[model samples]
Target: MLEQFGAAIQQVNLSTPVLRLFGTTLALLLFVLVSRALLSKLIRTGIQAPELRRKWLVQTRNGLILLFLLGLVLIWGQELRTLALSIVAIAVAFVVATKELILCFIGSLVKGGARSFNIGDRIQVKDFRGDVIDQNLLATTIMEVGPGKLTHQRTGRATVIPNSLFVSEPVINESFTQDYVLHVFTVPFKRDDNWQLAQQVLLDCARAQCEPYLESARKYMRRLGDRRGLEVPVVDPRVSLQVPLAGEIHLVVRFPCRQGQRSAIEQAILLDAFGSHDFSGKRKEGDEEGEEPSAVIE
Candidate 1:
């Protein structure tokens, strides 16, 4: 009675769906192995050339393996289909859980495709401006730059921004030219001051400071323009006058300088211009307070 009970339980288990699938898979695999062995034997004995025999044997083995995999899929197609549906549902849930992370990854891809900025390049996006120090899939690390745009000085802070910002904001690459860039700054003066003299003083100072590399910068600009089919601007020092208010005048100066030297060059020019007697609107010794200097604007 005990032996009969055990036999009946074993028969019931074998008749279940999972056990039936397993048995079918095993039988299919056995058939594939037998087929492969018979084909290999036939190739080895029938082919006269050694190379041909080896090639046929390899081909037969590969075909049999492929057939075995196909048979497995066919035999377990229902189970595999169920498993695939479950996997897809899990994937959807996971994606919903990590939406921000996915957006960051997509942003990184966008940045790469656009070739917007790179390591050591100065860039500004939205309100953040800095030199890129490091970057990964999730965030970009930059050394903070500026109390403002005119300052062009580092704030000695590191900022890690999420890559997702790249997808929505326009990126300004200050160091796009690599080694040289056109830097602009402004000097304000009172309307009563010697505005003309100040403009000339600033222009002269700029020309003097940039004279050394003016030719190189010009050539670089020309080459870049030609390569990109752009109308390149003149690289010579220029000072434009702007009167935004009734009592003030702004001398806007634009000059070319080496990358990372904009602040220094601007400082040098300001020092030279302010230190000049004519620019300071100060009369020389023994001159009337209201009298203009003997120096004439050329």
Candidate 2:
């Protein structure tokens, strides 16, 4: 049986097509090698400059290798095509088995091609929001940014998200502004609460907190708009009123601040607004009974 098996293998190896491919491949490789060696020697002798000689040798070697490859491809084209056809079903099965990995690789390609986001950028995809710490073909690692979007604080945990998500989910890059960002936060108030007073106080606090970087932010935004051909909103502090439900009012304040100082600026504005007016609607000791304190900050 061993003898018969050996004979069978030898027969297959010595088949006409196999011998032809092997002979052609060997001839091409030897030709390329000899041609490269001769050209290298000729270049060294003909070119006095070391740099020019090296350049010529490299180009000659590359050209010869390319020609050798092309020759082999032409010689084995029909055989390769037949082999490919034979494996079509197997190839389909392989693709199905590794669909996710293929998608991840394609997603990486998409990310790179689009220049979607970079390391150190704060990005949000679906429910994941974080600063991209590392990235690879398979997944991206991020330092988790928040328990909620409003907090704008790191959660001290790392999340590895499959790169495949890049294909399906929209990525929001918060750090696109680099240093300064237009941060928006909401202060909710009851309809019966003095919402007008709350809105005014919040606006004042935002303007005061954002005053230092307001002009710089504006200029940066204007330049960004001109460069990107975008219609960017003004960086000035502004407040808008929203009514999400009956008897519920939301005061949305948009303010410009350093990217890293969003939470701090927000806290400062909240504290200042809180101190300026009594949000609890509780009367002070000096106030008579039935005197409402102010609009409550929910």
Candidate 3:
């Protein structure tokens, strides 16, 4: 009876597919573990540059996960094939139900393909402006800068926006190709008091304050223009006079500056302008409290 029982067990083991499935699963598991260890070792010792190492590690990790999933699917594909029609129907229903989610995914793909922006890029979309700190398939994370649509100063806020905005709204790329950006501000003066002299003083102050960035920006922009087959715009200090209000003249100055240093440069320019002989003894036509124009930087 014991011999017969052992014979029955042997027959059952031979006839069942459990052993084959176990063997295949073990093999795949071993492959995944060995490949991951080898790739990690290679990333640690082979890659020297920090940026390159980071990039390699990310790509390799993602690739390994994808490869493991593919192996599993291939191994169990026969079983999955039986349910393909049901899976397709479910997928279609899910996609139809989650239309916004699908649109966001597709928008992310489009953004990636277009390379419209990258990590650390300063972008403004639909009133949200900041540096992109993180990005994923569904949303983008931004460190808030220039809140309330006021100045370009960082507001110490972090925001997450859906990637679908890339498809629906306009994106303003402030730090594209060149690191330097134009800082614009307006200084107000009474139309009667040394306005021309104030303009000269403002221009000279701008040139003196932003001189360091001019040459470097010119070279960088020249290279960018050559690469893109576009003309490089003049990147020097520009002063223009405009009459936004009736009685005051606006001295608008736009100068090349680093994004982070815009406020500092604006302060420096304002301080210098205030101390200038051109801006002293003002208020020829307007009251000191009501007519005195202040410097507004943006």
Candidate 4:
């Protein structure tokens, strides 16, 4: 192409193309740097529009810099167009060589760039749970929790999930719409114990612990309503005890929790609830607390 187009323009020595390429590249670098600096300064100082603050400068500067680069490239006339077309063909070949990686990158943007989940948001996708540590094109990383406290299968390891998972897996975003989580605890019931009275005592304890969260949920919902155009939600505390599984009464405690604090917070609540209550179906003068001859509910 260079030979074919030589007679259409100024004739040069054997070193002409090399010198022109290097010189044009250097000029482009200088042009880009100068344009970026001036654009950044203008966005920072000249732009006085208060409505366009925080992120306005970066976007404006990028636009100006791109325009400057495009103009600089256009200066080469027809020769540059031919070169650019050849470069585009080579780039297309390169992309075809790594199609999977490009797809992964696009999938990552769709999943992570949507602001769907944050670092501490409690999310369950496929078979993983915990706080997300790092999300990238190839994989999403999480600090796994909840081993045997709630269920038998322990997800105690940091797992890397592929970006394609969002398209297929049912992602349970616990903190997506609400900050308060319902914690259901079930305990065994004894035939000899006064079930109603026992329920009241447990209710009072659960209510006291969950009161702050209920208030928090209300305040958060109101803020969400005002700021994000969301509907206001009311928080309700609930407890259900049922006699089932091996003839044991399950003491269920429903309460609110911060987005990422489910497993640890639940464990803490269980500890405190057990510490304060004598859930033991039998009562003796020297009997210890919560030593009931029934199975414990998670």
Candidate 5:
């Protein structure tokens, strides 16, 4: 009787092979979910060390999870060789089906991983100029700034642009290096306010106002590069003098700026210059409107 009972139990256990397979699959699904959560936490912890690249770690983690799943399916679902072939075929089909999407996703991944730009980066991708707000597999969301001038102070309208831009256009990342820009205030003496003395005064003032910013910018740029594992600084404030249109000598000074500060900086420079000197536009209200006399916007 005991022998017969043990034999019966063995037969019953082997009867539901499909049920066992389903239970194993369920367990695997739970494992994958738990592993993903734990892995994310691990990645966050690892980001503290400066030497380790977070992007590479994330990529490796993803690949490991996928390989684990693929191996499990091949071992438990059916014949290993057949399962392997089917997976390859399916991957090829998926790539062909979503070619454009794959390319865009790859591009975004590269852009993000390299720390090329951040959420508030002022980037001009093709023709859509704006501050980046969101990035994902398909599209990048941006708040449109302007057309010719590319100003960021706007009415809160955002645009969703495709990641794979067809236009072969340049993407300008303003403040990709440093913030705190400079603008020169030209104060021309009316040939009587001691032109040389006035120039000296203005130049000295500009230097004092902008030098500190330049030094700070350099230091910050260096720090940023070091933190991100980038090797160079992409921005520097420069000031110079030139005579292109003919008038009082033009002092050209550029300072670092956060996004959307160009116009404000220009206005501030104008106000400061006016407070110290007389700036009679002299020409008619509209006479030099577009003629662009000795005035240089850049």
Candidate 6:
């Protein structure tokens, strides 16, 4: 009778719905714990490539966690379904609140993956032109350049521009194609100061000082023309005469030069030209001797 009673009790225990569900939940919990341990070991010791390993670990961990959560939902599907509306409403509110921040982050991702431009590159956007000093998720900082005392000169100020603007505005990357750029500067001389001789001297000085840059510029320009169908300009130094003001004829000299070395090249050419002749466009009051003139900008 005791044996019969024990057997009947065991059968009842197996038949109970709540007891069976509890046992199943315990088994699933155990499975999850064991699987998590194995996956962690695999991610820590198995992967070789650093980048791939990081990506794999993140994706796999997230997937596993999701599966674990899904299993729980299956166990408690009725309970979670009741809260689904609240979950979706909270998600929508959060997205709307952080819309601009999210957009900026997306812009940064696009910039990094696309490689639109890089640090030290000279880029112009929205009337702001400068060398990129720093770039982050939200904005880019640049050392500003402009006209007058700021002509191709830093203003000792940093301009921070938002990365989101890159989506709509055009970016002029001067340093993207090559390290050298075509720099044009005009040297003005009085009509009486042998303008013809001044042109020849200036031309010779440019050819000598900018020899290295000229060769590279031509090669890059040719490559651009072939690859992008751009019109390749004449690479050789050219000096053209322009009379934009009275009593002065300007010799516009165009040459390929390093972006960082523009001022140095201009100074060198001016010094060399000054030694040859009095190349001045204007003289100060009561000036007995011819004063050295600087390059003029329009």
Candidates in order, TM-scores: namely 0.66, 0.66, 0.71, 0.55, 0.51, 0.54
Better of 2 and 3 by lDDT: 2
Question: 3 or 6, which is superior by lDDT?
Answer: 3
- Write model 3 residue lDDT over 113-192, tens digit each, in one string: 88888767789999899977777667888889875654667889999999888888878888776478777788787766
CA RMSD per model (angstroms): 16.1, 11.8, 6.1, 8.8, 9.0, 11.1
lDDT of 4 by residue, 9-83 (tens): 555566687678778867887877787778777777866764353245544554565666676666556666678
Q: Total backbone clashes of model 1?
A: 0
Model 4 misplaced stretches (Cα beyond 4 Å) = 1-103, 148-156, 177-198, 212-214, 225-233, 241-248, 260-265, 280-298
How accurate locally is residue 146 in candidate 3, as Cα lDDT from 0 to 100?
Answer: 78
Q: Which candidate tops lDDT?
A: 1
Cα lDDT tens digits for candidate 1, 1-298: 9999999999898779898889998998889888988888888789997645755665576567668878888988988788986699788999999988998988988998999987778999888999887776788888999987667889999999899999888899999887799998988888767676676778899999999999999999999999889899789988887889998878889999998799899999988988764644543455445444233222
Clashes of 4: 15
205 Cα displacement, candidate 3 (Å): 1.5
lDDT score for residue 226 of model 5: 87
Give the least accurate 10-residue stretch of model 1, judged by summed lDDT: 289-298
Q: Could you tell me the C-alpha RMSD of candidate 5 in Å?
A: 9.0
Model 2 scores what on Cα lDDT?
0.82
lDDT of 5 by residue, 117-234 (tens): 6666667776677777666556777877765443436547798877666223346776475354323334333422333333333444444445545676667767877887987544
Clash number by candidate, in order:
0, 0, 0, 15, 5, 0
Shift in Å, residue 243, candidate 2 = 1.1
List the global CA lDDT of all models: 0.83, 0.82, 0.78, 0.62, 0.58, 0.74
Error of 4 at 174 (Å): 2.1
